[model samples]
Target: MRDLVRQGWTITAEETAALSPYIRAHITRFGAYATDVPGIEPEAFDPALDEIDFTVLDLAA
Candidate 1:
């Protein structure tokens, strides 16, 4: 999300892996990663990555 981006956290595993151990540990300690954080909107732009059928998925996949 934009909040995390603004705080310098990578949104993907690849980018996260490229980060230094210090930075990565900082993120793990203090990063804000939540699917629903009051007002931030989640993207479903990609079927492979971002597409989330929350209702169906949450119910029982």
Candidate 2:
């Protein structure tokens, strides 16, 4: 659309710089395609605690 506008109007660097990449109006008209996945969430990892052995070790003195 910028290119289309650029054909008629002379957009300067300042005007172009003001443009947003977060412009969502163009795609919002298409509506949303939603998906839900249950019981697929990953558990958080704790390397130090998870890797430790809870069992006691008896050592010779």
Candidate 3:
């Protein structure tokens, strides 16, 4: 996630929700990593969904 952000992609809210559980768990147990991404605020994570709408910004466009 951080890698994508560093490369100029945007992780949408749905995508964040989809990944939130794993990301939160990882961050809690393994320490900071993906949460370091510019727009990935820890407060926004929600892991209660079965599906997500993933989108990315196309900087080339």
Tally clashing residue pairs in candidate 2.
0
- Write the residue-wise lDDT of candidate 2 on 1-61 in tens digits: 5776768877678987988888566577666755676657778876778666666545422
- Model 3 off-target regions past 4 Å? 20-61
lDDT of 1 by residue, 1-61 (tens): 5799999976997876777755443356766677667686666666565555565765574
lDDT to native, each model: 0.68, 0.70, 0.68
Clashing pairs in 1: none
Q: Which ten residues in a row have the lowest lDDT in candidate 2?
A: 52-61
Top-scoring candidate (lDDT): 2
Residue 14's lDDT within candidate 2 is: 90
- Please tell me which model should have the higher TM-score, number 1 or number 2: 2
User: How many clashing pairs per prediction, in order?
Assistant: 0, 0, 0
Better of 1 and 3 by TM-score: 3
Say which candidate scores most in TM-score: 2
2 versus 3: better lDDT goes to: 2
Q: Write model 3 residue lDDT over 1-61, tens digit each, in one string.
A: 8999999999998988776444443356755566457885557777865474444335435
